[model samples]
Target: MPTGTILVADDDAAIRTVLNQALSRAGYTVRLTSNATTLWRWVSSGDGDLVITDVVMPDENIFDVLPRIRKMRPDLPVVVMSAQNTFMTAIRASEKGAYEYLPKPFDLKELTTIVGRAMSEPKGRPASPAEETNEHIPLVGRSPAMQEIYRVLARLMQTDLTVMISGESGTGKELVAKALHDYGKRRNGPFVAINMAAIPRDLIEAELFGHEKGAFTGAQARSSGRFEQADGGTLFLDEIGDMPMEAQTRLLRVLQQGEYTTVGGRTPIKTDVRIIAATNKDLSHLIQQGLFREDLFYRLNVVPIRLPALRERLEDIGDLVRHFFMLAEQEGLPSKQIDQAALERLRRHRWPGNVRELENLIRRLAALYPQDVITTSLIDQELSQPAPSSLNGEDASQNLGDSVERYLNGYFDNFGEALPPPGLYHRILREVEYPLISAALAATRGNQIRAAELLGVNRNTLRKKVKDLDIQVIRSSR
Candidate 1:
C-alpha cells in the first residue's frame, strides 16, 4: 500500500537502477537521477514525496542540497545513503536533517522498511542543525559493530534522552558519552563526570546534590554538585553500578521530579541535565542483590548501548592501531608503522583489557621502540611480558595478594599528603568479598549450600553476603 513518488539519486547507474527496481516493487512511483541537482530540482518543484540520495554526486554533494530541501520542504523526509560509512559521515547526515542514514551495501528490505516507516509517520520538522566543528574524531573503527554504534549515536545526537552504556573496562564508554554530549543539542552545556567507585559512598549523595555549609561534620562552605555544574548540559555517571543505595535513591528522585535539594538545604533546585550513565558491572545482578534500585535503572536506561569489547571486533584493530599512531605522532612521539604480521599477532591475542590496553601497547611501541616499523617478534616480546600492575591489566601470574597490594598502593598514592575518607576497611572487605563469593558461587553452579561450605561460612550468612554484594547467582546443572 506504499504510495507517492520516490526520488532516487546516485552517481552510479547500477545503484540507481537497483533502488528504482526495489522502490517500484514496493509499490511506489520512482524517479531516478544520477546527481544531486536533479534531486534538488525535483524537491524544489514539489514533485517528490520522499527523497533518497547518495552523499556525493557528480554535480553537487547531497549534503549541500539537504539543508535547502529541509528549508523548502520540511515535510519531505530525506534518506541519505553513503558508502563512506565513517562515524563523521553518519553524523553529517543527521545534522543535515536526513530522516535516516543508510550505510551503502545495506539490505534492500531494510531500506524499503525505512521508507515505509518514514512515509507513514506524521510529517514533522527535522532536528535543528548544530554548529559544525572539525574536532578530533573521538571514535574510530568501521566493523559492523562500530557501524551500528555510529548509527545509534547519529540518531541520538539531536535528542536529550538518558543513555546507559555498558561494556568491559577500556571499551571507550566515556568516549561514546563524550560524543553524545559534544554533538548533542546541549553541545554548549558543560559535561560533568563523576566516578561512583572513586568517591567514598558516604559523600556520593552530597557530591551529586551539592552540600550546604553545615550539611555534615565537615562544616565546609557550600559546594555546588555535579548536577548544578552540568545544568543545561550532560552529567556522565561512570561506574554507576558502584553508586551506594542512598545515592541511588537521591538520583532516582532527581530523575523523577527533575528537581533536587542540596544537603541540609530546604530550597529545591531544578536541573536540566541529560544523564549519561556508564557501567562495567552487571546492574541487573546488582538489582538482584538489593544493592541497586530497579526504578533508577529503568530511568537511566532510556537508551541502552552496549559497547563491544575489542576482542569482539578484531577486524578494527588495524584501523585502531593506525589511529593510535596518528595520535602518537601528534604528541611528538616517533612515527611508527605496524607490519601486517604484527597486526595479525594483535588480532590473535585476547584483548582482555579491550581498546585501552591496545592503546597503551601502541603508545609504548611508538615511544619506546627505535624501529620505524613494528614487527611480529617485537609484538610477541611485548605480549609475553606481564602487563604492568599499574595499568590494572596484570598477567595471570599475579596472585590475589599482589593484585590487592598493588590496588591498595595505588589507592593510597591517589591521596598523597592526605587521608582517605573513613570506612576503608569495610569498603575494601566488600570489594574483596564480591569477587570471592561470586567465584565460589560459580564453582558451585549457584548451589548456595556448596558455596557456603566451600567458603567455610553458614548458608544464611552466604545468602546475606550474596544479596548484599549484588553478585549475580547463575544457576546451572553442571
Candidate 2:
C-alpha cells in the first residue's frame, strides 16, 4: 500500500521538524506550513489528503479556517492541534467540523493511528463516538477536548483556588464547578448556591453578608448569609456577573481579607469558604464598559475553568448521549435509545445551549418520547422551540448567557472552536427582538407603553420588529 500524505502546520520550526521526522518514520509523506497563512495556501492549492494543524498558528485564526478547509475539500480529513487546549478552541474545532482535535504532548502512536485511519477512509470522518442507539450520557469519546476537560478537573482536585467557570448558558458551568468541588478537598462541605441575578438587587447584600436582627426593614430575625451558611464549604455563586457593584466590592473584601461581617454587625467574622463563581459574561468587556470591577474579576477568577459548548465539542455527543441515557434510566424513565439519524441531527445542531441543554433534551426525550428509538424528527421538534432553562431557577436569558460566557473565557484563553453561525446580526436581532417584543406585550397586557419600560426599548423599535417578525399583540379590553 502506498504511504498516505500528511500535512503538518504550526508556527514552530522545531515542532514541524519533529513532526516531519515522526510521521516520516511512521511511513507517510510529510508536508509543512509555518502558520495559518501558509497552511491555508497549501490547503487551497490542493496539497495533501490529511492535514494536521496547530490552532494558534501565526497570521491566522485557525478557528476561522474550518469553513475554508471544508470549502476546499469537504471530505478531506483534518486534525487540529493546540497547546492552549482550551474549551473554546476545542469547541471551535468541533463547530467548524474538524476530523479530530489533538492537544499538544500527544503520544506518537495516537497521531499515527489517527492519520493512518483518516487517510485510509478517503473521506473525512469527525472523531465522534461509535454510533449506537443507546440513550445514556456516558461522557463518551477520547477526543483531546474531552481529555483536556477531564485533565483540568483532575488538576483542580489538587488546588483550593477560587475557581471561575465560564461557558454558554447550556454549557454545564455548574457541573464543572461541582466536579471541582466534589473532587477537591472540600467534598464533604455543604455546596451552597446563590444566583446573583435571581435575587433582587437590594436583598443581595443582605443575603450574602447576612443581616442583624434589625439591620434593615423586614429583618424580623438574624439570618446567616451564604458566606456563613457555607462556612468551611463551597459557595457556588451562579450568575455572579449580575451581582451589584456594591456587593461585588464587598465580596472582593471578603476574598481579600478572608472574613466578613453581617450587614449591621461591626465585628468581623472569619470565613473558610471556597468560592466557585460562574458566569457567561465577558467580564473584561464588562470591565471596559465599567460594569464589572477588574479587581473582583481577578479575585473571583484565580483559577479559571472553561466548559465546552455542546456544539463546540460535538465529538463528545455520543458520550454525553450515553451518559444521559443512564441518567434517564436512573430517573425511572423508559428506554430512550437514539438511532443513527437522530445522533447525526444532534451532531449537526448549532446547540446554542451547551451540555446542560443536551442533558435536558435527553431527559425530555426519555420522559416524553419513550422507547422505539429516538429519531431526527424528535430532535428537530425539540430544537424548533426555544430551549427552556434546566432546573428552572431562572430562564437563561441574556443574564445567564452573560455568566456562562464569563466562566468560559476565564479559563479558555482563546475562544470557541466554531465561529458564531452566519447571519450573526440576524440571530442577535431575533434574540433582542423576541424578548423585547414579548416583554413589552406581556407588561402592557398587549398595551404598547407599559411593554416598553419593561423592555426599556422605545415603542417605535418594538413596533418595527412586531411588523418585521409579524408578532401580533392581542388587543386588551383593559
Candidate 3:
C-alpha cells in the first residue's frame, strides 16, 4: 500500500474526482484541485509527494508554473496529462520536467501504475530543460498510433541514443529524424543525410568518410566525410539496407571505436555524431540474404522506431490531409478544403505511396483545381488516374522492362548532374531477387524444396541461397 499524498490539478471537476478516487483507492492520500493556483500553494507548502497536473488550467498554464515547482521541490515527481496530445504537448511536458506525459483518455490502470512507480522510486532532480524553440510543427496527427510515437519521440529528445527508423517510402522517416535532431540535445549541430541507394557502392565509403587528395584516380582534394561534417550533430543514413558489405564493415568499426579513417588517409579521426538510420526495405530479410552485416544491424538497432504505414493508420488521413493543405497554403498555393466524403474516400485508398502520395494529391488539388472545396468526385478522378507503380515492382500490368526502367529513371533522377556509382547491375539484381525469393519462401512456408519448385530453381541452388542468405526457416507444425 502507498502512504504518500498525491496532488492532482485539472480544470475539469470530473477528472479531479476520478483521479482522487483512483489515487485514494491505491492507498494514497489524494488532494485534488481545479486550478494551478491551489496546486502551487500545496506544492509550495510541501504538502505532496507526487504531482499530477494537466497542461491547461483555469488560472494558468501548467508549463509556466512547472519550472518554479521544480526549483522549489525538485524531488516531487510531476506527471502531466493533456487532451491536446500533439507532438509539441508531449515535448513540452518533458521539457518542463514532467515525470510522465499521458494523453487524455489514457487507461486508468496505466495511470495508476505510473503513479505507483513514481512513488516507489527514489526521488531525484529532473533533467534541466533544453533551449526552447517556437518552431513550426514538425509532425501532425492525433490518432492513437501517432500519440504513441509522440510519447516515444519526447522521451528521446533529450538523449543521444542511436535510432533506427524503418517504414515504407514517404512515411515521413526523414521528418521524424529531423524532429529528433531539431528538438534533441544536438539541435544546434548540422544534420547530414546520405542515401546509400542513391550513391554508388564504390563511392559510398568516400562519400561517408571523405577521401584524401591523390588517394584514388579521381581524388582531387581532401574532403570531409559526413562523420566530420556532422561532428556533434546527427548523421542520418537513409536506405541503410542498400549499404554494401564493405561499407557496412567500415560503419560498424566507426560505431564501435567512435573513430574513422578518411579514405586514403591514415590518422583516425574521432567523431561525436549520433546515428539515425532509416530504410524502407526489410533489413531482417536483407540480413538473412547475407547482404547486411548482423553486427552493424545490432549496433544501429539500439532504438528502433518502426513508423506505421499510412494504410495501417487510416484514422490519421484526415489530419494529414489538412496539414498538407495548410502547408500548401503557406507556399502561395490557393487554399482548399476537402469534403468529409472525400476524406472518407481517401481512407479507403491503399495509399501505396503513403503520406508523400497524399501530400502530392493535396498539393495538386490546391494547385490545379479551381474549386475552393474539394469533392469526392475530384478525389475520384485523381485516385483513378494510374498511380505510378510502386518501386517494388508489384504491379504486373506493366512489363518488367518498363517497371525496371521507370524505377531506374527515378533512381537516376536522385542525382541531378552526376551519374550514380558504378555496379548498377548487381544492385538491381539483388533488389529484384530479394523480394522474389522472399515471396517464394513465404508462400512455401520455409520448405526449401517447395520454394525451389515455386521459383523454378534447382534444390541445390536454393539450398546454397538459403545458406548464403542466412534466411530463417520456420517449419509449420500442423
Question: Which candidate number has the best lDDT?
Answer: 1
**Candidate 1 per-residue lDDT over residues 180-290, each given as its tens digit:** 999888999999988775455678888899999988999579999999999999999988998878889889999999999999999999999999999998999999989
Poorest lDDT segment (10 consecutive residues) of candidate 1: 388-397
Off by over 4 Å in 3: 388-478
TM-score of each: 0.80, 0.56, 0.81
Native-referenced Cα lDDT, model 3? 0.84
What is residue 415's positional error in candidate 2, in angstroms? 46
lDDT string, candidate 3, 1-478, tens digits: 6799999899889888889888888899998888999999999998999999998898899989988988898889999999987899988888888889999988899999999998999868565583466657888888888888999999899999999999987788989999999999999999998766545467889989999999888798898889899999999998898788999999999999999999999999999999999988899998998989999999999998989889989998888888999997887766889899999999999998788778878876775555789999989987886533333444553666686687578656745676644455654564466556666776776566778887889876876665444343443434
By lDDT rank, best first, the candidates go 1, 3, 2
Model 1 earns a TM-score of 0.80
Once fitted onto the true fold, the runs of candidate 2 whose alpha carbons sit more than 4 angstroms away are 1-142, 385-478
Clashes (candidate 3): 2
Determine which window of 10 residues in candidate 2 has minimal summed lDDT: 129-138
**Regions more than 4 Å wrong, model 1:** 388-478
